[model samples]
Target: MKWTHSRLFLAIVALIGIVTFANLLQSFYRPYLPTITSLSTTNRSDVHENISHEDSASRISSGQGVKNKNLDICENPYLQPGYVWYSNTTEETNTTWVPFYPSLLDESYSSTTLETTGEPVDPYTSDGDPYFPTEQPPQELLDVSPHPWMQDIVRHYKLYNSSLALKQGGSSSRSREVLEREELENRLHWLRNRRILIVSDSVDRYQSEYICNRLGLELINSNKGRQTASWCHIPMWNLTLMNWHIASVSPTKPAWWWIQSMQIVNVEERWTEYYLPTLNDTIGMNGKSPDLILFHTGLWDHTYFIRAPEAIGGKASWARSLNWRELRFYMQRVRMVITMLREQFGDDVPIMCRSVTLKKSLPSNVSILNLDRAARFVCNELDIEIMEFGEIIRGYFEFYKDMVHIDRGPLSVLWANMVFWYLFRTQGGVEVRGDLIEMPSNGTEIVNVAKEWNTCHGDFMNAKRY
Candidate 1:
């Protein structure tokens, strides 16, 4: 009886050992099992189809799933025709440029004749359009808003480190490089999974380059892509920066004589052809549009009005019958461009007009400055914001070269920082008035400057109709 009991006990102990061993094995392999829902089983074609039916806002938020480990972070999926890379990195990516369904403009995209007369419609006319149709003047727009969030943000920055503000006294004495690196890191964090589009001349191209340099982003193509389109990418930030060099006028055949000879009309088409495609590339119906767009075109227009020959190292002649007398018409064209952009991107995307900076060497400089003012006046009509660099740079001719371009020291840094600040200030997920102060900071006061655009763009169909 004792021997039988011993054998039975041994069997029971062996059964217990098997159960414990199985549990240990299970725990070891559990983590290797899929923690994230994999999209591999989902058809790629279906993903594309789903994007098409979705709206812009809807598309932007679609990247809510687990970050895919298989996707190559180094690869630029949205790279346009001209972008090229000079270097490569092997580091694994933690952030991603979430894939988006490109939003192609449909039949709703329309073209209108920009009124040749740049004259502001009579404020008391039967139409009853205000002098500034959509918003208040620039300075006023800055004030009397929802807690002056932008002003508050600027105050948050200790930009006295800039040599220009030496008298401010509170500026940090840290090396400019250190400050820029810190600023870039903060911006990259905020700019993750976003894009920035810069439409400007060579001067602003330098601004774009400076930004890329600060971020340690290499210019992939350097000077090589479409003259109108140049792109720079930062894989770490998942940020794409592009420059569309759309000047004041379009380049046409027969050179400077094209304007007088009337060889080509609809001069704006030159801009639209290049601008539209590039802009289109940045937007996706079921994905996202660029988070910010900064634009400037008046300087080239200044060159155009002078009719300066390219042989004398002037900008390409693209103006169709544009002259000083027709400054009003030029102004109208500018407004139309702004309106078209707003119409395409929707009012939510912040479009900024870089205040024009003039070069003393240019002819009829006073009129050029006047044109800048006229352009700002039109910006208010279109409900676009002004970056105020023109106002900031005004009367500081010593810091500018050839009268229009800013020298590369403090002024350049200031302009880039301003662009950075404006973007970061308006970006989502930032602390708002309610978060900081004890004010009743409901979002109702957003339209204080532009009453007409206060209507929400909740319906894509309705927005398309507009």
Candidate 2:
């Protein structure tokens, strides 16, 4: 009986040992299997979503929607294969000579009377640069008559008083007092509940924050960074998921898969080569879309002077124009990316392109000629709106701290005003009370006629202007 009992005890011990071994295997393998499974699923989803979202977003953003067919007045000629060839040459011929506001131009006092001999010369020609004027005209010609559009542009130009214009204009219409009252009442109701998304690169952050503060809305950074809480009067949101850690060059091969898999944490490096890929990642990670997507990212590319090869179907002539090549390349990249975004987001997205701020004391080499040209091209082609900060910055260089970044003093006001203008235009709102100025009835005709006359006369007419 004792022997049988000992055998039973041994059997029981064996069974217990087997059960413990099975439990150990399950514990060790279960955690790893699910992790691997989840990762696989996520990666597949990301790939699928990236393609789908990008495709949809591009179509939507480009104003290709059925509803937009009626509303989209901006023609997109760049979509054609040979569109650039025609547009570039055609625009050069059809150049319009829009005059600058006399208030904005430098006025010099001279005791001698200036007289013209040949003809009413084109004021824009002899200047070398189209936008800038070379010789100051007599105060008589300066005050001759304000063009209709010129007057409006000048008035908007003066409303640069930072927060006040935006704050007052937010609820009112600049054109009519009755409309302003009605709009103000409606805006108050709307302000009670509405969320907006402001997307921008580092340069835009300052502007975005300032505008948000004025509106009593939160300013969020899409890029990963922290601004002092005290810096803003109102709360701001930051959507930046990663901080950049710029390397001299991009990884030669695909590294995102490995980086994401390991859950590696690092700053986002703004390498010239990595800009597109990084943008791709950012757009992918934007789990939900925002109301507005303001974009600005030409600075890094401008500094790097990176170019794709002609074999890749890039402009070979660009290699020769090294002077403006980087800027051109930057614009080309922007055009491609923006085109892609428009396709995905649709026309209702309200994309606004803020022209790059010029450095104080304009670089003898780098002028806004290329920047402005590129901006005008993109805005016209894409039917996207642009905030002409370049002109404003050029006029007021004192607001800048360095070549690129703006100083905190008046720069803040400048940026705030720009944001205000963008919002005002998009929300169907009007300009500030004192911002509207009347334009001459014949202003457009005069500018157009002057430009046409110059085209026929060529350099002969250009010489007369000098």
Candidate 3:
């Protein structure tokens, strides 16, 4: 009886050992199982599809889960053309130029009236000019020189060490070397001659203005008073001719010219009466006939409450209920504008959209639920290419002064570099660098005095000389 009991106890111990061993193996191999969820899986796909279809407000409120790993939704084999991934890193490294054969070339070259007027008058007239003229000069005629200040600016912005900033004596040779390394001179020269338009809200106006000033292009604001009826003409012997109309305000006429408009609207205002009509008007007129339309409108919409006027009391309520439904309606309006632009401009016109910028801290009555999730849902539904501004600015938060605006120094340099990199990738134009010119960093020292007036205070009485 004692021997039988011992054998049974040994069998029970063996079973326990097997169970322990199995658990250890399971824990060891758990990490080796797929860390990323496959989008092809039935469960994940269904969830994503539902999230994508939800109203922007509902998505904002619910804060749906987004698989960060599967950002490249347009990567499928049957993807449409002109779906660009706009990133400074990717543009600098991964982009390759493909010769774009103009679809209307055969039709355009055959027309005589169009050539003379610099406009498409008739589609059928045959002219002596070759159909689909090429504008880029032969590789030999192209100048591949870098701007003198290109290196200094790049170093100041990119080189993190303050010691380098102070110790590094500004050298023309060093500037030349930097420019040569990045091929900035040639790139700038090409860009100077290309017609490009920048349309943005107040936040991006400084960058856009700086770029225009640096490149010798006119800057026009969308605000009514700032509008100017000026046309920018680029003279190139090869088939390259571009015209620019930079306006902060929506254009009065349909943009029939080869215009590339950058649309950056403030999304924060209430959509019921004031902001919606303005947006609709802008979209109706300027959204069509764009060669490349870059859309960015997410920052202002989140983090703030939009309160309707109370019927009984005059005072604004702190616990004012938000009109999220109205917000989603405007978002859908934006989507419609995108669709119309795609239809009018054709699918090949590159549409680059931007995600909302991140705030350092959350606002009162606002949670993370209202911002990023809404942006992701709208982007998914619209089928637009997203430039992940939040992710890009994560490491470089110091570049920003406040919640939204960036410092002028870093902002200008960053925009210039981005534009340079983008133009390089898009095969738009080479950099144009003329004689080396140096100006004061700040415009404080002006030799000639314009009438000194404090516009904010409306005081022109005091005139002091520096």
Candidate 4:
């Protein structure tokens, strides 16, 4: 109990060192707060480390002066590191999604219930907000979840599923896994039980599988698909992906739904009538619509509907996929499809039209550019959003698993992130724009806050990330 003067001095020095190290750790994880703020909602979370270090976007990247200036929680909610905490309960119908992000629990927004209320912070049962575009991509080819929290999802999933992570680790790893499980489980509770509808060819079917797998769930009960509409459901997560097989927005032949005998009469017009009821039976009617709807139809159309430029029925001679007449018709059909979906799902759910994905061969490629143009045109006109997967992987034939589907890798993750981005936009009441996320071509987009410590932003980023 008797301490010497030298002992006391050493103790004080040690205390200062510990405090400095802790502060350094905090800065390493979250460099700055609120690069941009959400303009729509009021109850921004004060829970997690808020990071909005966005001045890098305007500054352009160089070796020098990687300066950063960020906004606070009052401005943009979707900026990095800062996320809203949501409460989830076992009662499926009781959860409240973030419709708008106003501010960091601003005094003006007492009506908001998603934030903390002096109770134990059981986010799984608290009202929560939908968040997204969480992934900021890079030039690297094999990207995973684009945001830090989402990266946690992948880390937890891979580690949990791996043989080493599951079987080899001892009590230390087990304890770590237990803590991680609780954290990730509470964080991802908002996305579970949310049904996502994908109406396209097999590519989206793979995409659905990726989304489920990324979330540590798997799609099961698959039927004879890859040609017709088939689905796989994960009841544990209450997540369902429905893929309706339509080659064209306009009717050309029988659709590839489970019902092999789809009538060809006005098929495009009638697609939704059948699709919705069938989806109702699958995901349930209950007046509850899917949380997100993604659709793109063209590969089948090119192969079956669009006539050959040189020969009316000759598929080989068709040098082009879009003529003025066909383009007009394509736009009309897309509009009809979107209109039908809007009427059925109501305005709450997000409806996104995926662009026509690229194929490897030139014959198949001839029409994709045109097809994409037409799809984008109609989607833009109708206020229906577009997911430009095609544009992202354009000309990268090696990324294709086959002639159509994109292989599993960064491309796949990007696809899921696009879906997440659109979902948040719709749920958050944010205006949908294609170029909202900062996509720098120089491989400098920073999901990890530390990487940006020295990276320049803004006009300095390349025209396209490699």
Candidate 5:
């Protein structure tokens, strides 16, 4: 009986040893086992599709998912082109550019104390300390409003910096050097390496400041003083956005280059001396000259020099009532400035003359309107392009922050879209809408956008039913 019991105990011990050995061997091979995989690469296409459908606003919150590694060759982007203004107010199936609403919900987005600095903030990343828009925007529109312009900027900003919105060039497996060369092609292709110069007054300055902030350019060194130049550059793309405050397009001072080149140019001394040297400095500072030049000058000329009201002693009207001599001289200078820019920047370089913005004050407003009409005539003669900046903001005089500047929130975003959309359209990345009218090249009368804004806006859809 003792022997049988001892044999049973040995048998049980042997069974235990076999089970332990099997488990140990299985443990060694556990990692190598063909079990479930946590990697979801197979779902990447599905994820890409899902992310694509979500509105541009929610794109920011989508954290750490598999990114579409391949930069897509952007063939057709949803850029609507029209002479009339558009919005996505009623939630139509067809998306308008207005659809990009930035939704960053951090409370830090709110403005704490009112700042009267008079410069517009980047609606995308306003810290509220320095970047706050004037006197704190209407809390109603900011806090609970459906379309937060500030938040909306981020959506577009991100799209421009991403793979989704297709820019006009390149598709290839390339060496680093080859890739950079391809990128340089995107300068004119996407306005990436391109530089633009805006030679004007304070009106343009507000837009420049806002644009720099929106695009992540450093602004600490930007000059805010009158008649001086300010610069913003991004090295990665080699883009330079420069604004030269030649407050008076018809400079009282003669330009050095003009004096040297033309023995008897115009009675008005050239501003080339002051403005051109500054352009040189801009080129030196950025290691590149401007690819495009946006030129304007009217308000300062109207108030400061052009029209001083017919004095109590019977002098002349205050920048209004049409000083024929000064107005003619103004037109001549407008002609001269364009001629000078063409001569200096080379005829190949495209120069766009903006339709002069109307100052809110009456006498000046009339003077400004005349300037716009006169400037348009010159632009047409010079074969230059016009950005209906005047047309876009003329009706929104109520939105004028300082009685001069108009676009701050979504309007500023519109400014960016207008500028860049022209680039995209001209470069063949975007197509013009068949529905809207192009600026009448042969417009006989000065296009009064202010009077016609409402009528023109309804032209496509309202007429669709009619």
Candidate 6:
């Protein structure tokens, strides 16, 4: 109460020092301050209460709400360290588990949904797409033999079963049959109630035949009659593979014209009576449309009209090369087939167009163009997937005989196994395995003799995988 000059001077000096310290503190924290205009002190409490309520409601809706008095709400966001508000965000218990992808929620990012169909995303699923020859192979002497995996497969079954048969007092044929059945069962189980329909020419039929043998189905004799369409069933596997033959989806000329032009005419004449009927009956055999339909045809069309040296089934009979008009019509017919399948299946089935199996075949305009049309019209339009099988097998054309048919012996097994691996990794959602068989040198050309196969069966005992 007693005023003194010295005491007043000291008080004034202390006040000046305190003000300087406050200014220094403010300048140090200025960079971290939020740019928003500061709220009045009267409304700041209400704002904090509102944010706490909003966060509480979000947590409750996300099923993570539990009162935790120790948890502090974001009150002074600007003063707090980075992402402190994110700590306030509660983790939800109800969100369905998804594969941890950093950019999964980004709008510009998209991916195939095959792995997310309530199935675990395994290594093969996350791995890159399957490899195939998409270009004409250079003249490199690649070993055209059974893939190493295929040889291992042959050894595992043939030798092991033969030795087991000797010990059990059973014939080697009995051992072969047992192992064949077991392999079939394994393939069927891997398929997991899926069906495949392969529509192609004689070359692809060889593939079907190989698959049938693996499953122990009897091969139909061709000399008796070339079965335009046939199927074999494995009841335990609940799987059916149907091989349907078609030279071209769209013929260059009228039915009468095709009939008169060449001995091996385009089979468009049989569209209604033969092709469509077989497809209608064969597919949906197991109370469901085929999971996959592989369409392969360009080789037959190219050979039939182009007078290529390796004309399918013999030499080309055509006197002149087919003009663009004919080629366009052929493409139209192929496009029509894709449209027809989409209309029939209603986006439930995945259709793939196999590119022409020929050396330097990437530029085979017919196959590439038709496949593009399919992807656009059927896959994109129908909101489904129409794959290109050629992408996976295009690289192995060297292993193919005549650059058309997959070489029967071990090469055929390789090709078939490639297809199986693709289906298993991409669609089957199961462990990958193959149903392979060692074929005779004649390859898949001739109708396999069942009686002979049941007997010695083409050096099966003498042939070593190594």
What would you estimate as the lDDT of candidate 6? 0.43
lDDT of 3 by residue, 195-262 (tens): 22223333455555554444344544324223221122222201111111222112122232112242
lDDT of 1 by residue, 207-241 (tens): 66655565445554423244456766656545566
RMSD of every prediction: 21.1, 26.0, 27.1, 21.2, 23.4, 24.1
lDDT of each: 0.48, 0.36, 0.35, 0.50, 0.48, 0.43
Best by TM-score: 4
User: Which portions of model 5 miss their true places by more than 4 Å?
Assistant: 1-189, 220-226, 251-274, 277-289, 305-319, 425-430, 434-466
Model 3 off-target regions past 4 Å? Answer: 1-183, 187-199, 213-218, 226-291, 300-305, 309-327, 359-361, 364-371, 394-398, 401-403, 428-466
The lDDT ranking, best first, is 4, 5, 1, 6, 2, 3
Tens digits of per-residue lDDT, candidate 4, 392-439, equal: 456766557787777765556556555655443332222211212322
Q: After the best TM-score superposition of candidate 5, give how far the Cα of residue 392 lies from its true spot, in angstroms.
A: 2.2
Runs in model 4 lying further than 4 Å from the true structure: 1-145, 148-151, 158-174, 212-226, 252-274, 281-286, 305-315, 424-466
What lDDT, from 0 to 1, does candidate 4 have? 0.50
| Residue 260 shift from truth in candidate 6, angstroms | 7.7
Deviation from truth (RMSD, Å), model 3: 27.1
**How much is 397 displaced in model 1, in angstroms?**
4.1
TM-scores, one per candidate = 0.47, 0.39, 0.38, 0.56, 0.49, 0.44
Error of 2 at 56 (Å): 42
- Residue lDDT tens for model 2, 1-466: 9999999999999999999999999988863441111212232223222222122224334433322211111111111111001112212211111222212232332322343445334764553332322343434323321112212222322343333565676844344544444443333221111123333344555554444444444544323333211122221122222222221122121232223332222113223323333443333112322234455544433333323333355532322323555556546666765665565554445565666665443442153445456655765576655555544445455455566666544445434444433323322222211121111122111122122212212222122110
Q: In every candidate, how many clashes are there?
A: 11, 35, 20, 34, 16, 4
For candidate 3, the 10 contiguous residues with the lowest summed lDDT are: 448-457
Q: Which of the two candidates, 2 or 6, achieves a greater lDDT against the reference?
A: 6
What's the distance in Å from true for residue 263, model 5? 25
Worst 10 residues of 4 by lDDT: 136-145
Which lDDT value does model 4 have at 143? 17
